[model samples]
Target: MIKWIIFDAMGVIFIVGDDTNDLLVPFIQGHNKRILKKTINEVYLRASLGQITSRQFWQEVGLGAQYPQIETVYLDTQLILDDGFTSVARMMSKQYSLALLSNDVSEWSAYLRNRFAMDFLDVFVISGDIHCRKPDLNIYKRFLKEAGTQAGECVFIDDRCKNLAVAKSMGFKTIYFVRQPKKSDFVPDASITSFNELENAIENICQQIIERVIFY
Candidate 1:
């Protein structure tokens, strides 16, 4: 039985702009998306893992001189809680353990916690705290250990197919959240575009699992 529901923070619980584009990309004058993406990716893991401060990260990208201004723009970036998902999470907390597993920088994560009320969450496995990001087997193992639950007893929901694929391989039921589906080798057990479909998808999965157990 699924005793826990693990949620990804960025695209799932919190809406960060219209898409997952980098917050600083647009604010940077004369920016090249390709080079910017490459540069950010190079240092993103280390920054998310809390090995360096956000200022240090921008410095590595050669934006150290404009770090303060970029930081202001980044902070001003639109980010809001998905009310529908928050409501669902609140309701689900009564029946199942609810957790947040996110890849985020330490300073921003702290800012989010202070800005939002997350009392309904039973566990929070943040990459900044653990120094490991998703799609990394170690992070998932850490979440399992912290939550005190087996992989089979959890349902993992993420907006990225790659992340879901990793969770599925680790034996956790996976759900992919996206607006328009594209072809992918990593098939999710369920795909949802809106928060409205989430509850039903989860229910259907649980029902199917129960039926299989009964049959065998």
Candidate 2:
């Protein structure tokens, strides 16, 4: 039975517009712009797992070079939806322990910390402070150990399949977040496009928890 729930921040809880790509990678040639060798997925993995510094992560993508001029635009790109906060907070509070595990930049993350009273969370693991990123195994392991919860007792939800795969291998039940069909490849216990879907999933999972206890 799940007693705790963890979430990935960027795609799952917030939506960044197409301009994110432009802000992240600003260089363009006369006709074509260079593509990133390491996808955002890879960057996030490294960041969340604490494998690289924020500077190092952005430098690899050529964005670090122009960080000074574009920093504001880059940091301001993130948008936190009111509906998402209402949904996730409603389901995860009181009944279940909730944590946010995210790979994020220090400056911007601090901004969010002030904007939202995420103190409601039982725990929050952010890459910038810890110098660890996701899919590294260590971060997840540390989170579980420090969170004092067993893998089977927790559910991890992320927008990427690879991230979910890693979480599953570590014994977490995972949900892959899809923006459109609300489903993805790895058969999440539940997949949702909007935060509002979290209430139903939480209720359903808690019911299963009750059933299991009763049967046992």
Candidate 3:
């Protein structure tokens, strides 16, 4: 049976999953017309990997002296919680341990969690804190270490299939989260278009696990 439920921060908990595409890219484009999206992406990745400080990220991205504004004007004002997720999570928390696995800047992750009041989470393995990002294998290892559970006992939910690919390889049961369903080549153990559907999908996975153990 799954004991821990690990959710990705961006898309899973927050409404915007791909912050580079949804939040950062547009912010950069609007603020600095000369910086290419490629530069923004690379610098962002460095920040997420803990290779650079949050202040340095802004400076490198041509937003020097703007980290304070960013916390207020950008992330604080823009990042939104997924509607109805907190309620569902409260109910689910009684049944399973909830944790977070995210690729985010260290300071940004903490601020976001505090802003949204994610007190329900017990473990948070953030890339910015650990110097490793998803799909690299080490990040997931860090999660398992921090969570004190094996991959099989955890259910990881993410909006990005590539991150899920690595988790699946590591023996994690994955649920793909999408705002809306579309034809996709990649498949996960379950899929949900909305947060309200999560409990049912998790229950279904648990049931399957029980049945498999019975059969064995």
> For each candidate, what TM-score against the reference?
0.84, 0.71, 0.94
Give the Cα lDDT of each candidate.
0.79, 0.67, 0.88
Q: What is candidate 1's CA lDDT for residue 3?
A: 93
- TM-score of model number 2: 0.71
- How well is each residue in 1-216 modelled by candidate 2, as lDDT tens digits? 778888777777666422235334342221124645346546645654457655665665556776554445455544554456645575567788988887776655666756666776788877766776676777788788779989888888787777788888877877766754434456666676667777777667668768878999
Runs of candidate 1 exceeding 4 Å displacement: 16-20, 28-37, 58-73
In angstroms, the error of model 1 at 67 is 6.8
Worst 10 residues of 2 by lDDT: 23-32
TM-score of 1: 0.84
Q: Please give the distance, in angstroms, between residue 9's alpha carbon in candidate 1 and its true position after superposition.
A: 1.8
Which digits, one per residue and each the tens of the lDDT, describe model 1 over residues 167-210? Answer: 99989999888844667888888888778898888888899889
Model 3 lDDT per residue over 31-69, tens place: 888999999999999999999988898889888867678
TM-score of 3: 0.94
Give candidates' CA RMSD values in order. 3.0, 4.4, 1.5
Which residue pairs in candidate 1 collide? none
Q: Backbone collision count in every prediction?
A: 0, 10, 1
Clashing pairs in 2: 47-133, 48-132, 48-133, 48-134, 49-132, 49-133, 49-134, 50-131, 50-132, 50-133
Q: How many clashing residue pairs, candidate 3?
A: 1
Please give the distance, in angstroms, between residue 103's alpha carbon in candidate 1 and its true position after superposition. 1.5
Model 3 residue runs over 4 Å out of place are 180-184
